[model samples]
Target: MKIKIIKIVLFTLIFIIMLSCITKILQPKDDGAIYGVRTFFAQNNNHNSDILFIGSSHIHCSINPAILYKEYGISSFNLSSGSASFWSIYFYIKESMKYIKPRLIVVDMYTINQGAPYPPDFIFKRFAISMPLSLNKINAIRMEASKNVFHYYINPLVFYHERYSELNFIDFLLYKGRKNRYKYYKHYIPSVKVHLQNEPNIKSIYDVSKLYYKVEEYYLRIIKISKINDIPILFIVAPYVLSNEEQRRFNEAERIANEYNVPFINFNLNYGDYNLDFSKDFRDAGHLNDEGAAKFTRYLGKYLKENYDLPDRRGDPKYYSWEMNAKYHDKDIYNIELKQYTNLNEYMEKVKNADDYVIGITMLGNYQKNDRVLQSIATNFNIDNIYLKNASYVVDNNKLIYSSDGSNQYLFHKEIGSYTDLVIQNGQRLSINRRNYIKTKNGINIVIYDKFTEEIVDNIYLQKY
Candidate 1:
């Protein structure tokens, strides 16, 4: 009887271990926003931020921590889950406090109208998968997940087991551990697409309906936690293409904020102060693109610096990681800006405006020296003439680094970072690490490199019809 009991226990342990391994392999990777940001915050000592930005996608799309640190020397993080309701935000705030002690908490009020007792299943899945086994998470599962779906959130394998058939090598790799993808952006993702739409003329309606009971309850709970922790909380409404109904809801939120004596700012009504151009700033009706995010972040950074007692850790050795992350952010912004232009003329014009680009312009075969576009580039670069023969020009920033019109004698080589080299031959052939990038040799070949990242951004071949 004793031997049989021991055999049963050993077999059970082996089965449990195998099951754990299978469950991990089938689990999805944590996107930097939902679970990854919280993991990053807990792991990195430098991520003990001065301010915490929390809410829905609006906060993630608008509030950029790198920009805040770069422009104002203020350390911050965006701990936003996409489409998270107030209940989720409350739990997120609870989870975040275990990692970092923040001075101020900025809450986005965009999700105030979400009246559901629980978030959508997809969003709930993200929350459950991201949270570890804790009393807080258990309570969240209990209250937020219904009895029918509770098992699914707790043991995700119940639902995700089918994913095993769809798994690739990435799934096996992630089963071990995942890296912090949002390290550079600090949990911010920038959208580059430009969306042009007329702003809705939403008149303030003071007599709008009251806030949802659950929303108000969770919101107050957040405020209570902030007060208990001695952290100041600021409420904000991020600017978006608003509707009359949304504006009315925001009006109701403002009244609540006033009652709580919390500072509230609705950016939709004060777009003029931020110099927001609706045509170029928005990626969609609801979110700001990179350009718009820059403007909004700059304004907020200045406001925080002036109003709050935040430290400026710009040149300090302790916060050197922030400086490096800022450079990475700048590189991403430059890359996005370069990718937006397809026309050679417009692309050259943008490069001319930015001072941190290494530009290579080559003309191959027979080309018109008097071409208007060539003349415009020559005028901007202050060149005396445009070459009619095969010619190559390398401009570092706005300064002429190297220029050669010879077809055979022109050979330029520069090591990029550690592994790659920028090589040019005879004004026509352009290669990075001997990999051909020029689309055509018959016309003009141009390559642009970002000075901050030391990486090639774009290669363009333009021909006149």
Candidate 2:
């Protein structure tokens, strides 16, 4: 009898160990800011965030907290998910309040018009997966799902069974420690691909007065939560080309903001003030690429400083993390900006002072004339035939020179981050490093960090140009 009891205990222990290993291996990888950073920040956050942002993917991709911290010195975190409804946003705020108190909440209005999809359990899973099982999460699932309560909440294993196929050594080894893909960007995923289209002033027939009651109720709840906590709320509409019908719907959001007496600003209406070039700055009709985000963020940062009582924490020691986050965030921006030079002379000069890199350049075929990608390059950069002259220009001491043996020739662009070797002419190749960012291809991975403080100054998963 004693031997049988001991055998049972040993069997249980081995089974538990195997299950633990499997869980680590099957955990999901970071897809983007919404998919990657929300949980990471929730798990590792120091609860030092002063500003809290909530909503859907628009909030995650548009509001760059690290950029805000760098310029305004206010620390923040983005608690957002893909296709998040007002219902989900309210619950996420509730979850955040359990851990930390923020001075203000910024709400993005992009998802306002769309009603929460029925059977809403799966949409909220991005957040549910990372958060510990708690009453806050339980209540959210109950409200969102309103069915399958047991399968959705009691057992996640059923939904996650398919993830076994996605498992890899990196998932278990975590060689670099719990991976935080967006740690460098402070949760802002920069978009670089440009599709030129202006916001059309088209008339469409969509009723704004008919917004679903559940949507309105959730917005009101968001307002109520802010009032209960006495946390000031601000509503914003990011830059996106909207139809007249969509614009009218956003007017409803404005109306609600006024009813609540909170500050509201629509960047779409004020885009001209920021010098936004629709042809150059947007990743698509709806989203602000990294370049557009920078302009809007800088403008908003200045406005917040002038209007709000945000403090600059640059010199404070307790908030040292903010500075480090800002450094990494800036590194991402520098990497993108470096690839955007429209002038060959300027581009070569910038590249010369920086570290060595490879640019995948391919010749343009017929019909390449209408290629908007090539046309977007400055008109001055055009040539009848790109192959006639070699682009082997290297920067030496901030000067451009043509070199044959260009094995080790890049050196300028001081303080740049990971790069996405965009096609300087038409067809170009790029490199992505272990950090999963665009750094120099097939070369030594170099990190430009603050050795003095042990903080990253730049990271290029490196962006592919």
Candidate 3:
């Protein structure tokens, strides 16, 4: 009987080890805002912070903590993920307090409008995968997860077992517990996408008639907790394309804030205050892209420094992580700016008035389509296929005219073109690189100009293959 017991124990231990190995080798990739929150908890250590911001994906990209630290000396952390609901946030704040002591809590009041039991399946999955196991999570399951509480808590693999087939290097990374640095806007996601024009103007369709009972319940708990701890809590609605119906719901949020005496700032109504251009600022209708985030952070940092008593942790060796994170964060911003040169018109606009950048107006592609010479490059050279087509270019007040197949003969889909007569207007005077062309000939012209001297610093012509 003792021998049989030992065999059973040995099999149990083997099964547990196999389970851990399998789970590690076959997990899905993480994305969206949950990736940031997961990294913070798994690898980062933030025992003390001057401010803590929490909320949905909107806050994840809207508020940048690195900028706050760089400009205002604010020491902060973001404990949020995409689609974080009221009860979940309440629990998150509670869990975070175990390690961090923050002076203020900033909650973005966007998801509060959804109010209720279980959210949509996708958003719920964000919580299921990102949230760690604890009593608060169990309570979260009980209150919101309802019947699937056991499956969510005790047996996550039961739902995700099929992931075994989709294993890859990312799965290994997941097993190794790799994480991203906080250089990414603290918890705020930077935006690289720019939606300039042609966006539809959407108005609100529904008014939030009443708050979800659970939402009100959890929101009240937040207020009560803040009061007990004597910690200042601020509720804010980040800037987005808000509709009138949505405005009404947030108005309801404001009413509740007033009832609790918590300050609520709706940034959507204060776009001009932040000088945020909706077309250029938003990554999507819901989130601020990188450029907008920097602007908002600069504004918010200055405002916080002036209005709040948050300490500046810059130059303090104890907060060296913040300084290091700031460097990486700016590096990401520089990378984002690099993407703007992809479109030809955007590239020109960026260097339109600038002088320090290197502008290369060269023929891109095989030069099959007769196209105009590139106008200018600011920071780096922009080689776009769009500019390497049957197009005409007139630069330096017609000092140089690059015509492909001639304007009188317009080919519908002709794909043969070249860069001819590259007129480079650097600082002053048009330096035209006139290429010797035979009939149906193609080559590239380059003009390097100094902006300050207004002089043709250098020029060249080349063959495009």
TM-scores for all predictions: 0.72, 0.68, 0.68
Ranking by lDDT: 1, 3, 2
Q: Candidate 1 has which clashing residue pairs, if any?
A: none
Error of 1 at 284 (Å): 0.4
Q: Which 10-residue window of candidate 1 scores lowest in summed lDDT?
A: 174-183
lDDT score at residue 407, model 2, on the 0-100 scale: 29
Which of the two candidates, 2 or 3, achieves a greater lDDT against the reference? 3
Q: Candidate 1, residue 259: CA error in Å?
A: 1.9
What is the C-alpha local distance difference test score of candidate 2? Answer: 0.59
Supply candidate 2's per-residue lDDT for 248.
74
| lDDT per residue as tens, model 2, 1-465 | 999999999999998788656654565655452344345344455477777777766765677777787678877777767767777777777777877777778888777777654435556666566555678777766776657554645455665687867775456544223233334334567777888987665334334554567877888888898999998888887777877766777777778878889888877776679998888988877778877888888887888778777788767886766676676565555555666776645653443344333322222223234644333321322233322222222222232222222222232222222321111211122222223222444221222232221223333221113
Model 3 clashes, total count: 17
User: Which candidate number has the best TM-score?
Assistant: 1
Each model's lDDT: 0.76, 0.59, 0.62
lDDT of 3 by residue, 1-465 (tens): 999999999999999998766654654555455566665566445764788888888777887888888888888877787878888888878777766767888998888887557777666666666666687767776766658445754476775776767765446654223232422225556678877643323333334457788888899998888888778898988777766666777888888899878899877666778788867887778778888888887887787678677888899887776776686566555444644565645544543434332333433234433423333321223323234332333333212223232233421211111211233221122233332221222454444333222223334444445
For residue 128, model 2's alpha carbon misses the true position, in angstroms, by 2.9
Candidate 2 — which residues are off by over 4 angstroms?
Answer: 1-21, 31-45, 119-122, 149-154, 173-185, 202-207, 337-465
1 versus 2: better lDDT goes to:
1
